[model samples]
Target: MLGNAEILQAMEQLQDKLFQIAVRVLRKDRTRIQVSYEDHLRIFRLLQEGHKETAAQAMEAHLEFGKRILIH
Candidate 1:
């Protein structure tokens, strides 16, 4: 089993990746595609609830929304 430190490190790495993606999306259009705190909380809650598929779909939707903002 992974130790606590190792798990924390992995989570931090995942957070970094998500942050990078958000930054890329914001670079496209900050005014339109800004992710709200509520959105982040909802995604986190879904994951915490063990709804992995739903969480993945929510994340995908969020990213696609960002892409749409860029296209317009």
Candidate 2:
């Protein structure tokens, strides 16, 4: 598995974009941090359990949730 730094380096551009959008939303609504953290924890737990398929879906839901927050 790639280290976090290595993974970030590999997807720096998209990560940067997400950072930008996330910052905007986070600044406006701090509660988003906990909500986002919950989503992340769900995904992380799924991965840790060796559930790749479920983890992927959790990740997709997390990203879609972020997208919804940004668009509205």
Candidate 3:
């Protein structure tokens, strides 16, 4: 079994890769609107409240909003 440190490191690497993929997809939309502090706080709050599904839906909505901003 992997050690705790090893598992944490692996998780961080996976997060980096996922973040890169998100950036690439968003970049293609040519959006200049960046994620704001309020957006982060909102997501964080939902997560802290144990609302994982709601947090994910909020994130998806945020991404969709960014894409729409670029399209218009």
Q: Candidate 2 has which clashing residue pairs, if any?
A: none
lDDT for each residue of candidate 3 in 1-72, tens digit (9 for 90 to 100): 367898889899999986875666567654432454567689999999999999999998877875565565
TM-score of 2: 0.70
- Model number with the top TM-score: 2
Listed per model in order, the count of residue pairs whose N, CA or C atoms clash below 3 Å is 0, 0, 0
RMSD of each: 4.8, 4.6, 4.9
lDDT (10s digit) by residue, model 2, range 1-72: 367887677699788977898898787778889998998898899899999999999899877877777787
* Between candidates 1 and 2, the lDDT winner: 2
- Point out the higher-scoring one by TM-score: 1 or 2: 2
Q: Tell me the TM-score of each prediction against the true structure.
A: 0.54, 0.70, 0.50
Model with the higher TM-score, candidate 1 or 3: 1
Task: Show model 1 residue runs off by greater than 4 Å.
Answer: 1-35
lDDT score, residue 48, model 2? 93
What are the Cα lDDT values of the candidates?
0.77, 0.85, 0.74
Worst-scoring 10-residue span by lDDT in model 2: 1-10
